[model samples]
Target: MASNRPAPEAPYEPSRHPETFGYGDFRADEGPWEEWNPTEDSLQQVRGRHRVAKQRGGGLARSSTVLGVGVIAAVGAGGMASANTGKPPVSIAMPDLPSVDSLLGNGSQETPAGSGTALSALGVSSDDSAQGADDAGEALRNRIMAQAERQQGQAENKATAAADQRILAAAAQAEKVAATQAADAKEKAAAEVKKQAEAERLAKLAKQYTLPTSSYTITSTFGQAGAMWSSGYHTGLDFAAPTGTLIKAIHSGTITEAGWAGSYGYRTILTLNDGTELWFCHQSSISVKTGQKVATGEIIGRVGATGNVTGPHLHLEVHPGGQATGIDPMTWLRGKGLNP
Candidate 1:
């Protein structure tokens, strides 16, 4: 049923329920509206118009500030990640809303669904995301540094190896130079030794030998062809000198003959230790007797033209091994290092 007489003077009390309500059901018939003072519990049910508006505006302001801060943090992290990896920015997914109790620290029985503002309702924390980005950046920096150090080590090793190779090459070159010098020095030493040995041999030969005559001019050589010789060939060397010029014994020997024979007016024969014979002919006088031993360079005779000769000269002949045929005395003397 409906009634238009008057509405209730008090608001409905849900505690006293009759499964239905009608007009005039909560009326106090004797009370005026001005006389009534509403209980605190009743006043909380309906907000004033200004209070509601103020609460709604405050919620909007808080939501705007929190959302702005969250957005900035997220963007900053993405930028840092992109710079480090040289990649696109990473997107952060929106989190589920926070509980009203968590946001307000108040004794609200509201769940996250009933939280006042959208940003406050979010479950993710900006600090946690920013800290993760810092960790990632640190890891990336460490990796890059490790790679750089590894490359530097490899380069250093290669440079060291190249230097070692260069040192080895230089050492080998030095060794080759030293070896060449040693070879040249050895050859020079050998040549010097040979020259010294020859000098010693010549010195020994000089001690035991002498020339047949001194201060005399060679008038004729052996093997000369002329009519002055009976055989049409001179067989001995001729030394021209003043009469009675002293002639020498040449070397130590025994006199085998000391007398004139045929064309030889005064002649002497010296038989050497080795059976070679030295013949001195055309002498003015002979000082040696047959079978007499004479020392080297002993005055054996005087120069004179006693044989078939034209002037005062001594004819000298050498018979190798006492053979009648003779070799050139000049050629034989040269073999003993005598220039004349």
Candidate 2:
């Protein structure tokens, strides 16, 4: 049912589809073909030529379709030859990559899937409870140590402060003691000077007390005397004077006894600070009392011959340390730097 016609005398050359039509190369004899238009004869001739070339003849076309299919099948079937498949393939993915050896190592290497390192380093199969316990224990130990250290430091500070306070207190006390001792020493020195001066004064007055009462006769010395004495001899100096003469304390002292005695009659005994005793005997009347302090030249009683005395006179005795045996009153008084 397709076109059937005689073939052209020659094969068509390469040109546009329009140039291969009836308008193409009609004849150079027809001058100026670029200007020539196509007619029915040229059209029929081109169509008839294409008709013979496109016509399929016999089994050659069917054989060409079968050959094309055979060539495609032959190339794809070549992979089946020498199929020596070894080594089972493995699939690895996230969480555990089995393909790490095949995929990641350098220079064509295959490494073991299970790592030889610790589980923690490999981030696999580690003990979570033990790690947490260790962290908590370390924190607790640190807190305890810090608290103990703080307490120790506070104790040391308190001890240092206490030691400083003790040192200051001790120093102050020592200074106070030193000042008190110094004052005591100064007072003692002044007292010693006053005592020496007083001693000198009393010594000078002792001789005068033995002087004659109103310039009267002595009547008797200490060693030899008349039979009117109790000690077998005159034990004291006797001053013969008028009645009612003044009897004075020889020196400053406290009166230890002041009253009438059985034999000495009115008497006063004064005790000095150095324990020397002054005895005034045969007084007409005593004006001082026991425990009374008297000064030098102070009138303590009146002179009278009320006892074993020859006449009206002052009987005076000096007893150092209040002993019974008496020393020579004249010589002792003179040694005290007295005028007598």
What is each predicted model's overall lDDT from 0 to 1? 0.70, 0.60
User: Backbone collision count in every prediction?
Assistant: 2, 0
* Candidate 2 residue-wise lDDT, 1-340, digit = tens: 3443543444322232222222334422211111112234533655333422221243323434553464344423322111112111122211211142332222232223332222222221224334544556677789999999999999999999999999999999999999999999999999999989887786666644433234556666678755677777877777677878877666678999988787887788989888988787888888888999977678888878887666788776778899977666666655555433
State every prediction's TM-score relative to the real structure. 0.48, 0.38
Q: Best by lDDT, which number?
A: 1
Clashing pairs in 2: none
In model 2, what is the error at residue 140, expressed in angstroms? Answer: 99
Per-residue lDDT of model 1, residues 1-340, tens digit only: 3323433466322222222111224423211212122334433655555222223225434654675687677666665554455443444544333343433333432223221222321333456545556777788899999999999999999999999999999999999999999999999999999888877876676666777777789978989999978888888888888999998887899999999966767999999999989999999999889999999889999998886778888888989999989889887765555555
Predicted structure 1: lDDT: 0.70
Q: What TM-score quantifies how close candidate 1 is to the native fold?
A: 0.48
RMSD of each: 14.5, 27.6
